[model samples]
Target: MDDNQEASSTKRLWGARFKSEPSAALKALSRSEPSFFRLAPYDLAGSRAHARELQRAGVLDANELAQLLACVDEVEHAFVAGDLHPIEADEDVHTFLERVLTQRLGPIGGKLRAGRSRNDQAANDLKLYLRDKARTLATAIGDVQAALVAQAEQHIDTLSTGFTHLQPAQPIVFAHHLMAHAQAIGRNVDRLIDWDRRSARSPLGAAALAGSAICRSPELSAAELGYDASCENSIDAVAARDHVCEFLFITSMLAVELSRLSEEVVLWSSRQFQWVVLDDGYCTGSSIMPQKKNPDIAELSRGKAGRLIGNLVSMLSALKSLPLAYNRDLAEDKSAAFDSIDTLSLVLPAMAGMIRTMRVDVDQLRRHAPLGFTLATEVADWLALSGVPFSEAHEITGALVKFCEAQDIELGALTPAMLAEVDARLTPEVLKHLTLEAAIGARTGQGGTAPARVAEQIARLKAVLDKQAAWAADYRGPRC
Candidate 1:
């Protein structure tokens, strides 16, 4: 074909409203086929919905509809088999797939676009893409959480110091400290599940920038495609990217949580702390230094969180200036989003592996865990329970701690005579609560760092995760 004929063939797929050819730079910049091909399964899902809708609207006979659907299936198979190559001439995945379908089925394939447009087509593809991604991410989060719970279960009785403002504030089981991470990850998983539900609405049939004149049933398409409902307004359907924004926001939040956990890992693995030893598989040796097992992965995971946040901010900024209906500026949406998703994909699995393989030194943890008067609060709590007012109890505990500090004595090491010197109310029974185990055990309230409470919370979280796993398995279907 000649240049003009080739251009006409490509432009014909775009519709007849344009009178002049787009500049080469504009066409080059406008391409989304490369990225869309990376998301071929999602495009195929949207194609399946569009083809069924066309068949329902009498645009194609049963045989033609079957042929078109079969062609779409062929395209997906080609993609999976590595035979499908996205062409540079194709503007986007939606256009590229339609071009391929037209080539395979001729005139019948052309009918698949009867009540569809790139506006709605792109929207639907993104929704399906996020649904699958969100579900996968939720599972990944669950895996990390499981690792955390396993660590907590193994160390439930191991005493450790819990910190507030970087200072030891109280005694807790090592398992309780680990369970806090699990709870944070569990909440992140919940966000992903909620995002999937919010993103379940189909955006099909919102042709070009408005509702199609053809009697296409988006609701039927939605049902067939496993969506909860169809979008109500075409303009808003095409213009809205809130679903994508929400997914990225949840991802950003996850990244923040991961960063916090990573920071802890980095600190714990450092020479200063020596509280844990990361697996050789998860740590790197220094180039010139003989004594370095660097927590580089943790640092990288922590650093990437800023990038995820920047991605969310960039997309929000891009959307901020755009007018109603589709705009070219919206094309900037996928890069940052795709980058953030890719970063998290790598970070989460690596972090999970790191956690699963790392070894915690209970002796070292205990040695450092009890420093800086971690049991001070327990002393105050004990005093209060023994008929002293809380304010007075706190003052007495503070003064006793100061006296112990001057004498180089731990709270547990204080003799009854020394204890009685600080307060006449001090008794043998009160000293029992001064022990780390007793202090932690005494905090049996809901959400406390007591072993029993942490165990209960873990079971509840496990049940929630088990249900999510089953739902995710069903979501993945027989392919899983």
Candidate 2:
């Protein structure tokens, strides 16, 4: 068929002026396109608002506007209640809904598209969708942070060996380390709240690339859609995807933080560490080995983080070279945008569950806390407090550590005579800094891992989390 006949053969929403319909493979790609499907709810909202404006402008009488809103509501209700499905010829959600409305409401339904284009409408839908999803993700992160805080409070005085480069370095409690993850999650919560506020601007009136001079007031549409303001310029409104990029970055960073905690879960549950035991409900058994119970939840979360990072990279790559104004390329942006939110939504709750259920082996923690001469720093600090030059004290502590290692004894296992062999500064009084408890207790500086400091941290974190909870709740809170 010739181009005009070809275009006429399968009628698309943007089919006019096109000589031929897109190639079959290209046309089929629309079904997989997520932008329109996800935008349906917001698109209906925009149409109702647009219809009222058209009536005010005398394009539609009051009866026509009322009829349009009633039809829009019917389509929305059917879609939500699972009673509506588009026909096979429907190419995209925008066209599908418009087709359904046109079929039911006759010519008046076609009048609804007089001053708007899919360009601005899709952008509007995206902002609405992400603003709501960001709030949900923030609340999930807060839940995970709360789990960590609750666990930390339980372990405020439980001592464990803190590692540097996977080797024992000093003594700290389980509460201090877990709360570090909670603090990181708190930042993620902040980012989501911050980004949601910044991204709530509306782009509905930016029809096509520029705008229609006679369209309804964008301010009114924006207010109805819950946006803080309308986009200042039409071009930037539809053309900009920086908000999408920033959201992807936030979710990707959140995944990385969760992966770090997952790694710890894997390590702590292992035979060598024995620091924690995962609940049977959250773990899986090996297929071939009857004796094996694995940390699959943590392992899977760690693997999924790579996918989240890849999604951010894909989103950035999609937008990097697109020219000004909207492009066909942007249709691909939805997958990563949606997937990042989904991935974090799934991972955060799993992490929170694991944190809530794990058993901490206190005896193992205390026993391991003093192993590998982890208290060398404490002995050096004691010498420094005894009025010795820190450099000399450091050397003296090193000598003591070496002497202990030569005899195959820990720093705390050495006697007064054995201590004197290393240096005169290594007195029986130095024994005060030798136990894991004393080593942990001696450091009472702010932000230290000392038991008292950890208690203070528990209080501070609760305050931060309670404030974050309020914001996340507000973003998705109750009406009125």
Candidate 3:
């Protein structure tokens, strides 16, 4: 093509309404903002639904509708095979896709946008993209939970130290600690379910913040796209971005939970703890230090949590000043939201792999389980059960812990004379509760760290994972 034809070909779909092309600064911002290549399939799906809406409203004849559908199908296929790419003059995804369509099928393809605006079209595309991504993300989280539950199942009886404020405070089964993270992940799954249900509604027919004057058939498009219902208010449908914020919050919260667990993985794999040895395949060696094998996966997962939070905050900032109608600012929403999903897609399975392959040193865990006076709470409870008031029992246990610490003796190795030094009310029976195994077994309350309770909790987590796995596996629809 000649230079004039090439320049004209680069012109935007909305350029005819303007005197000349948009300013270079606006084009630069527009190019970076939407980043809608990822949203291409979603945009096409929305277009297919909208095309039929147009046909039903008699905006397109049967022949033109058939031609448009055929052309859009080819565009979708080229997009999927990575052959289609955007031009510089292509303003956004919508403009780029239209350029491709009009290039293939002439002006007939232009009728597909009848009675619709980029406002509702972009909003609908985001809903579709998030709905699919959320389902996949929920499944990735479930896989991580499954990995945790599997590891916990094997170590349900292995003893370990439970900490509060980064200090050892109690003795519990190691599986109990793993299951705590699994439970947090289960709640994250719950949050995804709630978020997906809210996002399942369609916003396609809400043209530009108002109901369309012609070619309106939201219900038809909603059903074609597998939405449960259309948005109740057109303006709210076009302008609403709270769903995006809520989705990012769920992702951010899930990241925080994983970061906490990742921190523990780092601590456990350290030489000081030596409680769990990460698989060599999952860990990395240092450049200079010959003895270094670092838990980089866990560390990176922890570090990437900040990225998720930043994405959430960036979206909130984008939504902060926008008015009810759609603004150019809303186009900035997809980049961060899509990146958050992409971040989790990388983090979750790698995290699961690290957990599933790690080696647990049961002997080491059991050995140090009772070293830090972790059984003090058990002794206090035993004293209380022996007719001493809990307040007095608490004081007695505190004195005993202090004495053991000062003498460099473990609570279990304390002499009867050492016990008598604290309180004459103490008897040999208290010694029974001083052992780590005894301390772990004594507390059998619901959700406690006892082995049996840990087993029961694992079973419960498996049930939750089972449900979420089915949800993840079945991508047909969630209306069931």
Write down the TM-score of every candidate.
Answer: 0.94, 0.93, 0.96
Query: Which segments of candidate 2 are over 4 A away from where they belong?
Result: 1-11, 34-36, 476-480
Supply candidate 3's per-residue lDDT for 28.
80
lDDT of 3 by residue, 240-297 (tens): 9999999999999999999999999999999999999999999999899999999999
The 10-residue segment with the lowest total lDDT in model 1: 1-10
Give the candidate number with the greatest TM-score.
Answer: 3
lDDT tens readout by residue for model 2, 374-416: 9899888888888999999889988888888889988878888
TM-score between model 1 and native:
0.94
Q: Tens-digit lDDT track for model 1 on 1-480?
A: 221224346534764788787788988877773555666677787777777777677787789878887888888888778887766677887776777777778888677777778778777777777777777788888888988888888897788888889888888888888888888877877787777777777888788778877636888878767788888888988898877788889899999999999999998898888888999999898889998899888999999999999989988988987888998677666776678778989998999999999999999887866688888888888788778999999999898999899999888788888888887777666777777778888889999878888888878878887987876766631121
RMSD of each: 2.6, 3.7, 2.4
| Model 3: lDDT to the true structure | 0.85
Task: Output the better candidate (2/3) by TM-score.
Answer: 3
> Model 3 Cα displacement at 74 (Å)?
1.5
lDDT of candidates 1 onward, in order? 0.80, 0.81, 0.85
- The per-prediction tally of clashing pairs is 0, 1, 0
RMSD of 1: 2.6
After the best TM-score superposition of candidate 3, give how far the Cα of residue 338 lies from its true spot, in angstroms.
Answer: 1.4
Off by over 4 Å in 1: 1-12, 15-19, 427-429, 476-480
